[model samples]
Each structure stands twice: as structure tokens, then as C-alpha cells.
Target: MKKRNQYSAEFKAKVVLEVLREEATVNEIASKYGIHPVMVNRWKQEFVDRASEVFKKGPSEAEKALEKEQQHVAELERKVGQLTYEVDWLKKKSDEILNRKRP
Candidate 1:
């Protein structure tokens, strides 16, 4: 089977921009660019949707803080498991010692 052609991000962006400019229809743009019309339309819509947020800043500080809190919680859960195991081991040892002395 022959491998399909892969279009780069730059090429997709260019084609989407062209479609947005109204210089050509989606079908015409796809045929001229050797890409599928459906793919071209999808990219065009994505570009239009994200155009407003393109200039916006990255994730907010609250998002970053939540990520940090998640990491801390994972670490604490791991430590709790280790401590639980150690406590179980110590309890078994104490029970064995007490049973030996009960005679």
C-alpha cells in the first residue's frame, strides 16, 4: 500500500488563510493545494474559532496553582501508602511478641 501525503502545519495554515480571504471556495482551495476539501474546511473553522484567543496570554495563574496542588496530593498519597505498610508490619511484630508472652 502506498503511504499518504502529509501536510505540514504551515501548509494547512496557509490554505485556511486563503479560504478565509474569500479568494477561493473550500473545494477550489483543496484541489489547488492537493488536500481534501473536508480537511481544509475543518482547519478553516478551527482557525476562525481560535482567532480571537490567538493574542490572549497563556494559562492563568490559577491553573498553574491547581496543577501544583495536584502534584502535592499525589506525593502525599504515595507517602501515606508507605506509612500504612510500615504500621501494618509493626503491628504484626507486636502481636507476635504478645502471643509469645501469654503462655
Candidate 2:
């Protein structure tokens, strides 16, 4: 039994690009590359799906994590500020009530 041939990414991309450009039919490309038409179609689909990612300027994984952490810190700070305000209000109310009773 012979092992199946493994095509490189560059080679697959070239064939897929040719298919995208409509320079040749899927059957023609497969015949030229000696691969099955289904394989060519699959590569073309994958290439098209990831075409947008090639131009995406989104941050890396670490940057995304840092942004998320920063957001969490901001949320915690806001909650702390709210709690502090509530505590101060309660303390002032208690003091006013006590003063009225004493006077």
C-alpha cells in the first residue's frame, strides 16, 4: 500500500487562488494538480472563509485578555464607588437621627 501524498499550504493556496480567479474550472485545476475535485473545492472554501482574517486588524490574544482585565477593573472600581457612597449616606442619616434625639 502506498502512502497518500501531502500537499503543502503554499501549493494548496496557489491552486485555490486559481480557482477563485476563475482562470480554470475545479475539474481542470484538480486534473492539473493530480488531486480530486472535492479537495480543490474544500481548499477554495477554506481560503475564502479566511480571506477576511488576512486583513483583520484585531488585537492578539494577549491584548484581548488585557482589555478584558481592564474592563473588569473598571467595573470593580465603579461598584466600590457606589458602595462607598451608600455607606456615607447611611452614616450621615444615623448621625442626624441621633442628634435630633439628643436635642
Candidate 3:
């Protein structure tokens, strides 16, 4: 069995752009890239179909993920601060107890 070739997103976009440019036939672009002409056409169609997504307004998935991570970090920082205060209070109590016992 022959292994299937996988093309990167960048390469597919480049081929699709060439197709859209009308500078060459789909077959010519495919031949240049050693890919199937059908794949090139599909990419071009998909690109056209989703082109509006480029202008859709809102925070992207990456932005949402970053916000979630920042919230988590803030919660962790608060917990650390609480724990440090508790540790300091315990140490002070322990030191006072030792000092009283020494006298």
C-alpha cells in the first residue's frame, strides 16, 4: 500500500491562492506541487466558503484560553498568599512557646 501524502496548512493555502489568482490552471498548480488537482480545488472551495470567518468579530479561541489560564493563576496566587500567612502565624506561635519554656 502506498502511504498517503499529508500537506501542511501553509502549503494548501499557497496552492489555493495560486488557484484563485487565475495565473494557472488547477492541474498546473497541482502538477507543480505534485498534489492531486482535486485537493487543490477542494482547498480553494473551502477557503472561499470560510473566508467570512476572517472578519468575524470577537475574542478568538486563543484569547479565551489565555483568560481562563490567567484566572487560574490568580486563584493559585491567592491560595499561596493564604498559606504563607498561615505558616508565619504558626511559626510565631511555636517560637513564643519555646521562649516561655526556656525561662
Model with the higher TM-score, candidate 1 or 3: 3
The 10-residue segment of model 1 with minimum total lDDT is 52-61
Per-residue lDDT tens digits for candidate 2, residues 1-103, read: 9999899999999898889889889999899989999999899889888788777798866789999999999999999999999999999999999999995
Please provide, for model 1 over 1-103, each residue's C-alpha lDDT reduced to its tens digit, 9 standing for 90 to 100.
Answer: 9998887889888898899899878899899978889988888888888787667798766778999999999999999999999999999999999999998
lDDT of 3 by residue, 1-103 (tens): 9999888899889899889999999999999999888888899999999898788899877889999999999999999999999999999999999999995
Model 3 spans with C-alpha error above 4 angstroms? 61-103
Worst 10 residues of 3 by lDDT: 53-62
Q: Say which candidate scores most in lDDT.
A: 3
Q: What is the TM-score of each candidate against the true structure?
A: 0.52, 0.54, 0.59
- Number of the predicted model whose TM-score against the real structure is largest: 3
* Alpha carbon lDDT at 4, candidate 2: 91
